[model samples]
Target: MNAESIAIVGAGVAGAAAAVRLAERGVAVTLYEAVHEPKPIGAGLLLQPTGQRVLAAMGLLDEALALGIRVDRLFGDTPSGRTVLDMSYRRFHPEAYGLGLQRGALMGLLWRRVRALGVPWACGAAVESFQQDGDGVTLQLAGGRTARHAALILANGSFSRLREGMRVRQSARLFPWGAVWTVLPAPAGFPQIELRQRFRSASQMLGLMPVGKAHAEDVERGINVFWSLPVASLDGWQERIGLQPLKQRMTDLFPEVEPLLAGLTEPVQLREARYADVHMARWHDGRVLAMGDCAHGMSPQLGQGANMALIDAHELSAEVGTGGTGGKDDWPEVFARYTRRRRAHLRFYEQASRGLTPMFQSDAVVAPWLRDRFFGWGGRLPYIHQQSIATLAGYKTGWLWGRLKL
Candidate 1:
């Protein structure tokens, strides 16, 4: 394998994006996946304009736009309509609406495009271990399959098996509160073009985002409804009562979601998730590089997980250019450049997510007070409000770095 060649581990959004970008630059690349047929978990995701820009750069914007709901504003309010957040993409730019998309549809679209790009794929190739030296990186997959590449990309995920061995020993913290989410038919009075979230303090939280018809399943059920609860309480809570109580709680908190909540009469009808923060001192090691959640994963507080992953992939792929077989002499420095280019952007999101999570997902303790005093009002300030909007739209490179035009 020459330096122009890269073998990517994990066929997720990051891996696939990297593969397509590098391939487009006339580089030889292959994407490997642990599963033979990869599928997205049953959930919806918010694709911010920055992510849309990334896809647009990849020539996928039009295709992606067809698969999701277009949300012009992000509105978070208490039951009594006391505003917690009221940020509009139009505040940042006219064309900066967020995309409420079903994860399955996004993944499916990417997979098809990757296949069309003719990049080779090695599926069922679970990379159990890897060894990186000055020459190159070698991966040992399950069932004794082995592969080597001049440069290997670890784009797997937050809990990466390869990241621990290569660089950055990070202890990813699990949030005490996660979310229970599901998709159902949008109620008669549902807003089709906005992400409306209900929040009272922190313990009482619910999100209703309209996810368009991504696939056949979504044709009937298009709104994604989510309820935030303590992660530790799921087991005991489920055993102690039935879904009626949960539905009642959601209905009591956000009556608008009652139409969807009524269908969630069974706990099994929804999925729960606990977010984590994956921190790394740096994001590369010699010819081996980590991208996406493998390098820097943060909570969904900012809703930038997928956008950040797209940025990581695109940045690295751009740096790993369309040159001839460059060899090991140059890649390490190139990887360093990739880190430098991505560091500020990545750090801003991580810091923002950390500061924002407790406000929305915790027990509200002191965070609610802190949030109301700082975030709630600060977001209304002219300058700070725009900055917050830029951050939410995935454009901040640093605190004072100003907005980054994608």
Candidate 2:
């Protein structure tokens, strides 16, 4: 009823963050999520400087800080626990480097902020279809609830039906790998989790992260173990193996990270680790646009999926708050500008992440050895690591809002 009302689909982190930002600027927004209700899912997510900056802008930095553990340094090691490379976070970024937090907690925090801001939301109301008229876009819910908005943002995860109108295509490829992740109670005498990267010659990369706390009543508060094994396929991946085998294989492959895995009581095979990518010629069509994973779903190798979503929300807010590139009537040029601004940065991360995957999964002895040696040398190059962090964190981008001269 006031300002320009925008409808954001999928009230996940991206949608919630965007709604909060827009509401803070005095714009009314309505968020829609297909899920019947938010569920406790997902493990830990790495919050780098890019995400931290967005959280700070939204007054969530302090809260997130309290809920997260500041990783003092990053370590890369062999399966035998030999430290191959190590770098401090403070050395990379002056303000902060990275923090680990449960995805549920992060989403909970954003949801609270969205509700506090009085943004209207419709959950469990999956969109049946949508259409654009001369004035605005009309969204039809599966339950027959109809809504309209001057603009629409499709943040409904990777399988967004609303984004189909934009000609987006999705590819679900089975990486020669799959992963199992679960959280365990941090035993009273549990060993402090050292960020470990277990490099095995078998082309399997296993990682154990300290999730800080577990919400499950049955499980003691503890660490989250992420096992990325080279699976030839993901078909029936979930039933292929169980926690004990995974733990045993990991322990046998990388003894260093084995201690952390051994501490776990059981592993929750929450979701199958299948690599997917969503491609769209453009994320926007007229007043309707897409953001987050719906617009660009990428491999988790970069660990920047959520971070990139935050960035997308931030940039979209900026363009709209600044009057966008067009009036409410015309959004072609506006969407074009948004695409141009984001494509280059997206490609950089995409290429870099994809490049690293093969290296991690390579069975060739000489290749992996050379790859480790390269990383070893890279660790010695101070600027190389800084630059790596900057690029992945989206710090060095000219299009980043803070870096914008205008």
| Candidate closest to the true structure, highest lDDT | 1
Question: Residue 358 in model 1: shift from native, Å?
Answer: 0.9
Q: What is the C-alpha RMSD of each candidate to the true structure, in Å?
A: 2.4, 3.8
lDDT of 2 by residue, 279-362 (tens): 676677777788887777766666788888888877766665454434452444555667777776666666666666666664
| Per-residue lDDT of 306 in model 2 | 84
Candidate 1 lDDT over 350-401, as tens digits, reads 8888887888887757887666556657778989889888888899988877
lDDT of each: 0.79, 0.68
Q: What is the TM-score of each candidate against the true structure?
A: 0.93, 0.86
For model 1, state the Cα shift of residue 57 in Å: 1.4
Backbone clash total, candidate 2: 7
Q: Which candidate is the best by TM-score?
A: 1
Off by over 4 Å in 2: 1-4, 80-85, 167-176, 188-194, 214-221, 230-239, 256-259, 266-271, 324-334, 361-367, 398-406
Q: lDDT for model 1, on a 0 to 1 scale?
A: 0.79
